[model samples]
Target: MTPIGNLKPTIKIYDTTLRDGTQGEGVSLSADDKVKIALRLDKMGFHYIEGGWPGSNPKDMEFFDRIKKHQLKNAVITAFGSTCRPGVEPGQDANLKCLLDSGVKLATIFGKSWDFHVTKALNTTLEENLRMVEESVAFLKGNGLRVFFDAEHFFDGFKANEEYALAVLRAAVLGGAEAVILCDTNGGSMPFEIQQAVEQVAAELPGVELGIHAHNDSEMAVANSIMAVQAGVTQVQGTVNGLGERCGNANLCSIVPNLALKLGYTTIPRDNLSFLTELSRFVYEITNLNPVANQPFVGESAFAHKGGIHVSALMKEPGTYEHMDPASVGNVRRVLMSELSGLSNLLYKYKGLNLDKTSPEGRKVLEQLKKMEHKGYQFEAAEGSLELMLRKAMNGYREPFQLQSMRLILEVREQQPIHSEAVIKMRVGEEIVHTAAEGNGPVNALDNALRKALETIYPEVAALRLLDYKVRVLEEKAGTEAQVRVLIETGNGKETWGTVGVSTNIIEASWQALADSMAYGLLGEK
Candidate 1:
């Protein structure tokens, strides 16, 4: 086995979620949310987390005030801001002073690396810009703070004026910066360019620690960060799920696993690796953002095999189709049963269900699965429901409860004095129950009524709620009479599961999926 770490080489993970991630369009996290996320990041072992620009926003300032009370074991919170203004002294600049008073042990300051930004944006000469970088860093360091100088637009600046770019880094070094971070502000540099530039800087500043800060405009932030590491950079800056301005920054979610598992770089403890996928999902949930299905390594589809040939090969040897065991990254290899499934795929899925694959009943169950999949049933997203259905098809599988019939009545009143109402009658097992509810919409009313009727016998079912519901029209030619497919995601306190239903009526489709979701949860329960 490869040694976990060589004396724990300090590969720092600098998270900028609160600072840069909030810059993404449609993302604005409150101070309370930022503090909660910061606590989680600290627990996950991020060495440094950039909380926010303290003086930039009232909310950020409040975050700093509130976060000071909590004790973070493994992380140091860093305050972020731009260097002092063109002509102002470092001690007099409000932004510089904000960093000093923020009570943070570390501070990161961004200075102009591109000559155009310096002369045009700041309206200052290149030499003055270098002076600002040097003086601001020295002032922060003099205040007993560990300073990191972010060379914004470094790659573009280097290509424009190599001498000036090197000079900016030299100024920070002379000013006592602990690390010189190269920023691809525009996020347009390719991996080759990033590698070359980083290598040159590392050579020039042999004693200084090098860091990489990249954005994903080219969908290459993760690639560029890895390239920088390969080029001898010691630190990586990123946000979880790549949440940041524009296309976003490099995703630490991807970078951590890539470095630890693939490149053999040491950072997080090996046992903690299993938490990678869980943490990725947790961040997405807290952010109220949908996790990308195809995101490398941790995504739901990252290790899922669908095609018949691929599934057949995977059954014999997973290495035939998979790069590595997905469990290494806290994900499991999945055989998705679909129209593309073959006998081997069916056998593997059957084995997963703990049924004898060679039995006659198992063969019948496999045939039924293929037949249902032909009718638009998808097992990949509704694994729980699929497992329940498989058990029902087996010889000795017993169901917890049976649905006899259900009827829904909706009454809409046009008169101002009258109120609309929805009533449901459901026969669960042998008990018949009736309930009435009012909701903003027909689906909500139906869902409420159904739950009310089932709540008596199965109080545990009340904990489930619909997280997402999607509808698709299967046949436009049928117009208003067309078949509809309903996909419903139901989550209890512990876990979430998805189920799908297809029928001519939209209400019926929803009801079918809702019933499947409930049945899946009740499966194997005594």
Candidate 2:
């Protein structure tokens, strides 16, 4: 059988999000969640998906058991665990035995490579640790499973005692380990250190398969992993969005694109490359975490252009500002509206919305946008509202709905079921709708009341949900009486859009944003 990543200089991607990503703060996945992620990773064409260590907990074991439903197309489902304990025979160790029992064809077992961990952490002699490594690899191989050995804390180990670390790798090599992974468990190693360590290992074992596992404590995990691959490693291990314990692990979202696109190494299929952004969002959705907007590859702001010069240059030649075409990775170039926006930026927006850029209307809209921005409206982050504004300024513009009035009541009373309620009056064409709803907050009550009034006329509004709300005081000198700007993010479980509003009252600001959010979605489809 051909070895995984056996093609000339092929770089195999090993995703450990199911295991390590769950360690991220506020991240918790059930057995079903783990299987769901493994299936998605398989769809992304990862070479290996390290599901989890079956022996660690019941959820991991259940993941191994349930992931079989997928019948994965491209990825090898790998079960992860540690080696047999000191003084325990491989077959007798429950953890080792559990890995084999999990019925996966590939297994990864992490073994201590640091002398300090061996003598102190495990309370065992160095020889016993080596014995544990060799015997565990040999035993797993004897069970007809391909095994990868993770040299835990290998970078620090190599720095502290190079000979012992080399011996550990040699032990795994002799024990029929298919690959030996050098891990920067502490995540503090620099790129140069990784380069030198990997160079020595590559020179010593020219034919052996090498991998790199890195953490992100010093924020060099992605850098160190790349350097290790450049030196000689063929396999890269990381969690999606860099989620892991503490500072997180190497960000696979960055590493894979660097290896496959920039460096010209085969990682995932060329066709699967575009799914990175969607895949990143998938993990974020399942984990219930807000994605870091500024993340390098799959972030919301990764390709967002805010500067006037940048928008101008990008409108002429995108490559002048962007490293690559955003569409190549399922991302799109975003021309943002801001105080920094130039005429070219407005022209870009005009073209995007099919407006006549040379017309007097375009000039008027652009001037209004700039003036409004100066008054605390940030269209860059609220394109939905910006688009609606542009559309309304056009010759054939049609208002989707007319707001009659809204009465917001906030009651602070003990033993009350709700704190706030809103009564909304709106007109759709000729029909007027009235509704009242209670909510946890005045903003929520307004949202509920507005939706209740609109949903019957525009059924699509039922799918919309308020995802996030953020407010900032625009006039800081006014203190509590300052004008507030509110940004409301809304989504329909499929796509998300942002809208903004500003007012002296917080509730009024929130209501404007919410009303604009619903109106924009309703009008855009028309």
**All predictions: root-mean-square deviation over Cα?**
3.3, 4.1
Candidate 2, 325-398: lDDT as tens digits: 78778888888887777667777866756654466666677789889988888887798888788777776767
lDDT of 1 by residue, 242-333 (tens): 99999999999899988887777776676777877877887788778888998888899999888879987887788899887888878887
For model 2 the TM-score comes to: 0.87
Q: At residue 138, give the lDDT of candidate 1.
A: 97
lDDT over C-alpha atoms for residue 513 of model 1: 86
User: Which runs of model 2 end up more than 4 angstroms from their true locations?
Assistant: 1-8, 352-364, 391-470, 473-479, 489-496, 518-526
| Alpha carbon lDDT at 475, candidate 1 | 81
Give the true-structure RMSD of model 1: 3.3
Q: Candidate 1 at 517: error in angstroms?
A: 3.3
For candidate 2, the per-residue lDDT at 91 reads 93
Instruction: State the C-alpha lDDT per candidate.
Output: 0.84, 0.89
The true-structure Cα RMSD of candidate 2 reads 4.1
Query: Which candidate leads in TM-score?
Result: 1
